[model samples]
Structures are given as C-alpha cells and as structure tokens.
Target: MKLACIENIRRQKQHVERYKRQLARHRSGEDISLKSQKTFRKPKQEKHLKSFQVYKDVLFDEFLDKSKKLQKLTNQILKVLSQVWESPK
Candidate 1:
C-alpha cells in the first residue's frame, strides 16, 4: 500500500512540474503551440457571370475552328489516297 501511494505521489509531482513549466512559458508570451492558435479562413468571391460567359464563348469558338481545320485536312488526305488507289499500280 505504501509503495502504491509513493508511486501516485511521484506521478502527481511530475504532472505538477509540467503544468508549472507551461504556465511560466505562457506568462512570458512564449507558449506558441499549434493547438492553442486560432485559424481564420478568408471567404471566396464569386466569378463575374458576364465576363465568364464571354470567356467561355471565345474558348469554344477557338476549339471549333481548330476541329474544323483538322477535319478538312483529314478529308483532303482521304481524297488524295482514294485517287492514288483508283490509279493503275
């Protein structure tokens, strides 16, 4: 029983020493722990609807132009191949 009581006192003393050190650090303004810091998140602003629509339309027109050019080139190549195939070997 005495051994158990001594062990409890030792544990309590260690805890007290840890608490005192933390208190002293706090009083000196040196306790910079992540768990004690406050974090703030800035709010996000919405995009301008008209400007976004104009940008999207411009990008889409560019994409369509590129696709049309690619298709025309492919068709021309196919036509050339077909003529070569029809001609005598």
Candidate 2:
C-alpha cells in the first residue's frame, strides 16, 4: 500500500512538471509567432499605403480632367450666346 501511494505521488509530480514545461513551450512559441507576424505585416502595410497614394493621384487627375472639360464647354456656350446677342437688326 505504501509503495502504491509513493508511486501515485511520483506520477503526480511528473505530470505537473510535464504540464509546466508544455505551458512554457506554448508561451514561447506564441511570442515567436507574434514577432514574425509583425515583421511580415510591416512591409505589407507600407505597400498598401504606397498604393493608396498612387490611387489618390490617379483619381485626382481624373477629376481635374473632367473639371477642365466642363470649363471648356461652359466657355463655348458663353461665346455662342454673346455672338447671338450682338447680331442686332
């Protein structure tokens, strides 16, 4: 009976130590994974930001072109109106 009790205690100790080591390994592995994730995301974030700026530039150029076209059309209409008004009998 005493030997059985002693063996049970030993088994419990071994189990606790094994669990502790496994927990530590899991924590360290998580830290390594997070560090690598940050390293990987940094460059992707910069590239996304860079592309956003390029997209903004292209959108601005399109808006500017359309604005100039509208301005030109307005000027042509005003010139035609002026010519019609000046042709008095």
Candidate 3:
C-alpha cells in the first residue's frame, strides 16, 4: 500500500510538470504568432519579388542570346547569297 501511494505521488508530480511545460509552450507559441503577424507578409512578398525579378532577368538574357544567334545566322545567309550572285553558274 505504501509503495502504491509513493508511485501515485510520483505520477502526479510528473503530470504537473508536463502541464507546466505545455503551458509554457503555449505561451511561447502565442508570442511567436503575434510577432509573425506583424512581419511575415512583408518578408514573404520581398522574397517572391526578388525571385520574380531574377526570373525576368534570366528570360531577358536568354532573349538577347537568341537574337544574337539569329543575327549571326542571317548574316551568314546574306554572305552566301552575295557570293552566289557574284559567281557565274
């Protein structure tokens, strides 16, 4: 009987400690949520904007490269046409 009583007390103490820890966690979670409410969207939008700008820059660079290649191909074709015109068949 004495041993059972001692075990019950130990279990009660553990339960109380667990309850305190849970309450502490809940309080900290509230603080974090409050802080996030004020600052979350700004950082998220900034990150999205930054990524979008980078994507636009990449697309522009690709367009420039393709245009340059097309110009080179056009020049080569013009050169070939000029040669053919100058030479007798």
Candidate 4:
C-alpha cells in the first residue's frame, strides 16, 4: 500500500514537471528541449521490432500480468484515480 502511494507521487511529479516545461516553451516560442521536434511515432507494428525501440522498458512484465493477483489491486488503483484523476495520497 505504502509503496503504491510512493509510485503515484513519483508519477505525479513527473507529470507536473513536463507540464511546467511545456508551458515555459510556449511562453518563449521555442521547442521544449533538444529532440523535441521529432514527430510522433506510432507504436510498433511488429513486436520483435519494438524491442529495439524506447518503450522496450514499458514491455509488460509478469508483475503486471492480467491474470495475476495484482490485477485486482491494479483495478482498485484505477478506481481511486478515476474518481478524481489524481494520484491517491
């Protein structure tokens, strides 16, 4: 429970920081950072090709398997977050 809260807080901080950086870039009329000009890329059409891409880190692990016990715990977190779209305390 406590570890989940910490992870939520960390994600929230990252969200806020990205928003701040975007706002700063808008005000200055410039791209937010180096490499920011890259156009959006679609998800890989081939699973094997994605391994060479950035979201290689986001590949689903056993810990997030939909059939696992953590599945229900994950639902509860989604329920809480949906109520306000904010990370739980």
Candidate 5:
C-alpha cells in the first residue's frame, strides 16, 4: 500500500513538471508556430502553344462561321428577288 502511494506521488510530480514545461513554452510564444493558413501551389505553364494564339484561333473560327451563315442568307434573298422581280441588265 505504501509503494502504491509513492508511485502515485512520483507520477503526480512528473505530470506537474510536464505542465510547467508546457506553460513555459506558452509564455515564450514558442507553441504558436502552427502550419501556415495559405498553401503554395506551382504556377501552371502552357506547354503546347501561346495563350494569345489559342484565343485568336477560337475568335477567328467564330467569325468564319458567322460569315458563312450571312453568305447563305444573302444568297437566299437574291434568289427570291430574281424569281419574283426581273433584274434589268
């Protein structure tokens, strides 16, 4: 029973020592060095082509499709005019 009491006192002393060390660290501001909130990622690089060229190509394709549609509409209007009204040469 006496040995058990001694062991308990020893364990309590160790716990107090640990708690004091932790307190000292907190007072010294050494325990606040936590992981950073912001993470760094590698910047992506274009491997195949330049960004401007890619965008220009996309815009050119769009313009070409629009021009084709306008040409078809104009042709239909001219055909209708030719059939309904005679054109003077």
Candidate 6:
C-alpha cells in the first residue's frame, strides 16, 4: 500500500510537471500550429489563460494534499509495524 501510494505520488508529480511544461510552452507561443497556405492564428485570450492557471493551481493543491495524507498514513503504519515487531512473540 505504501509503495502504491508512493508510485501514485510520483505519477501525479510527473503529470503536474508535464502540465506545467505544456502551459509554459503555450504561454510562450510555442504551441501554435502553422497552416500550409491559409494561416489562421487564434488570438490568446486572457480569460482562458487565467482559467487554465487557476485549474493548474487547483490540481497542484490537490496533489499536495494527497501526498501529505499519504506521508502521514505511511508514518503511522511504520510506527505500528515497528511496535508490533519489537513485541515478544
């Protein structure tokens, strides 16, 4: 269970990192696709960008909360296991 939680946290971290990279790229205009002949570039909207930023912030906050919970659970489990192991059979 601890390993699974650790793996989940790692995956979430990677996902958030990937999202951040994509957002940065989009912000820098690196995500614009060029048309063959007719070029139609959509103007960046501040509203949409602000919403995306907010979404990313929310995701990050959720990730942090889950990780903290997992850490607390892990510590509790370790403490219990250590106590059990040290007791006489």
- For model 4, the stretches where C-alpha displacement exceeds 4 angstroms are 32-89
Per-residue lDDT of model 2, residues 1-89, tens digit only: 99999999999999999668767878886444454346544667888999998887777778999999999999999999999999996
Quote each prediction's TM-score: 0.36, 0.34, 0.35, 0.36, 0.35, 0.36
> What is the C-alpha lDDT profile of model 6 across 6-82, one tens digit per residue?
99999999999977876787799785433322464455797789889888767777899999999999999999999
- lDDT of prediction 3: 0.83
lDDT of 1 at 66: 100
Tens digits of per-residue lDDT for model 1, 5-89: 9999999999999778767888998955665344433334334665677787677778999999999999999999999999998
Give the top-scoring candidate (lDDT).
Answer: 3
How much does candidate 3 score in TM-score?
0.35
Evaluate all candidate structures by whole-model CA lDDT and list the values in order.
Answer: 0.81, 0.82, 0.83, 0.76, 0.76, 0.82
What C-alpha lDDT, on a 0 to 100 scale, does residue 14 get in candidate 2? 100
Clashes of each: 0, 0, 0, 0, 0, 0
State how far residue 68 of model 1 sits from its true place (Å): 39
Cα lDDT of candidate 6 equals 0.82
User: Where does candidate 2 have its weakest 10-residue lDDT segment?
Assistant: 30-39
Clashing pairs in 1: none
Question: Model 4, range 1-89, lDDT digits (tens) per residue?
Answer: 99999999999999999889888987998855655546556556765576657566665775477557677888988898798766566
Q: Which ten residues in a row have the lowest lDDT in candidate 6?
A: 32-41
Q: Report the lDDT of model 2 for residue 50.
A: 95
For model 5, residues 13-67, the per-residue Cα lDDT tens digits are 9999977876787798775323321343434564334775687667777899999
Q: How well does candidate 2 score on lDDT at residue 76?
A: 100
User: Model 5 off-target regions past 4 Å?
Assistant: 32-89
